[model samples]
Target: MKRVLCLTLALLSFIPAVLRAQEPAAPQEGLNTVMQKASYIIGRQFGADIKSNLPNVDVKALLEGINEAIEGKPSQLTEEQIQATRVELQKVMIAEQMKMAEADKKKGLDFLAENAKKPNVKTTKSGLQYIVEKEGTGAMPKETDDVVCHYKGELIDGTVFDSSYERGEPARFPVNGVIQGWQEALQLMKQGAKWKLFIPSELAYGERGNPAIPPNSVLVFDIELLEVLPPAANK
Candidate 1:
């Protein structure tokens, strides 16, 4: 379910294009057209999934609630409340997708565990699974540590999205400024140490696609920790 959720979230970015093309210009009436389109997509998708997953889900009432929330007249919910509801709806979608991702991940891991001589992967509490290669020995950096590092980041498909090593420049940043995966993993490495890290989507960017990375991406990084900047030098 976790694996499926991750994958589904990643795939949702692709859905907007298909849905937009099929959906005609929304009714130019009471509700804001843009909000109506967004609400329609979200409500319809959730309604369809609930019908399939939970037999008891009242799709009609659920949709009416969404529409009423969107309408925002006689204002039962404030503007902030309406926005919060939308965010909550999105989270529900993500949660359902995550459930599916977990199931798919288990199946994938099971197959690999059965077939491979030594499958190097472990699932974490947050439903993130990873394979660690070449454990490093040295002092790991804390979230506050300023560090110099060389890394090549890639998607599961071997597409090289970003690389400091390729650019011939070690990147510099405070460890906490990066994604949660990097925050956790870099803390495990020290100066002059190199490690290969396989990061799960939840630890990386679960649903949101950053500038280079797509949604639900499992990222691989060949990371070399060059130096941990001292306080004076960091300034």
Candidate 2:
């Protein structure tokens, strides 16, 4: 039942163009209408996405399934076949993800080992590494203190995932409310301090990463402590 539902969903994904045909695509002389241009652009994006994720696709079978679904016709494949496909696809995906995660873990371990040897970088017992960019004159924040700070988070490959400076605003949050790595760093930082942090996966999001992050990723952050406020009222 679940496999049939998954197959049904896969077909439904391609039929949205028919369901949301509010603005029609005109005759294909020159892509004149907004809907027509959108259709082509969306097709390109979807093609790229499917090419990457659904590796070694059977194009003929895929198109046949899509066409039948759009035309409201019966499925060509039997329930048993669909179930087999679902089970195999799931296994393949799990294997690929595990392989990737293992590679990332090894990469992170090597990176931390090399980074800890740098004269400027300080390593804590928890495997958090940091370089003090600028010393601060203000008092250090307690774990309960709310701090306003700007930070840029990135992967080891220099892919920026999050940044307060890019958003043109500083963020205010309790020191202990964040990930273990950030919590450790915030307590050690005083107002007006600047530091670059290398956070291991164990202290970061770890195996269960969010949409913006991947599993077993080693994260780097450039952090500036602006000001430390009293503990939040709700806290």
Superposed by TM-score, candidate 1 places the C-alpha of residue 111 at a distance from the truth, in angstroms, of 9.9
Residue 211 lDDT in candidate 2: 82
Clashing pairs in 2: none
If scored against the real structure, what TM-score would every candidate get?
0.48, 0.79
Candidate 2 per-residue lDDT over residues 112-161, each given as its tens digit: 99999899999999999999999988978898888889999999999999
Worst 10 residues of 2 by lDDT: 1-10
Model 1 C-alpha lDDT per residue in residues 1-235, reported as the tens digit of each score? 3443554475467557655664466567754566465556655665555556554557676557656855874656688998997788668877876776666455444543443344665544554444555555666788888888898998766799999977989999999889888888777676777766667666777666676765666677788888887666776
**lDDT of all predictions:** 0.68, 0.85
- Backbone Cα, N, C clashes tallied per candidate: 14, 0
Model 2: lDDT to the true structure:
0.85
Error of 1 at 180 (Å): 0.5
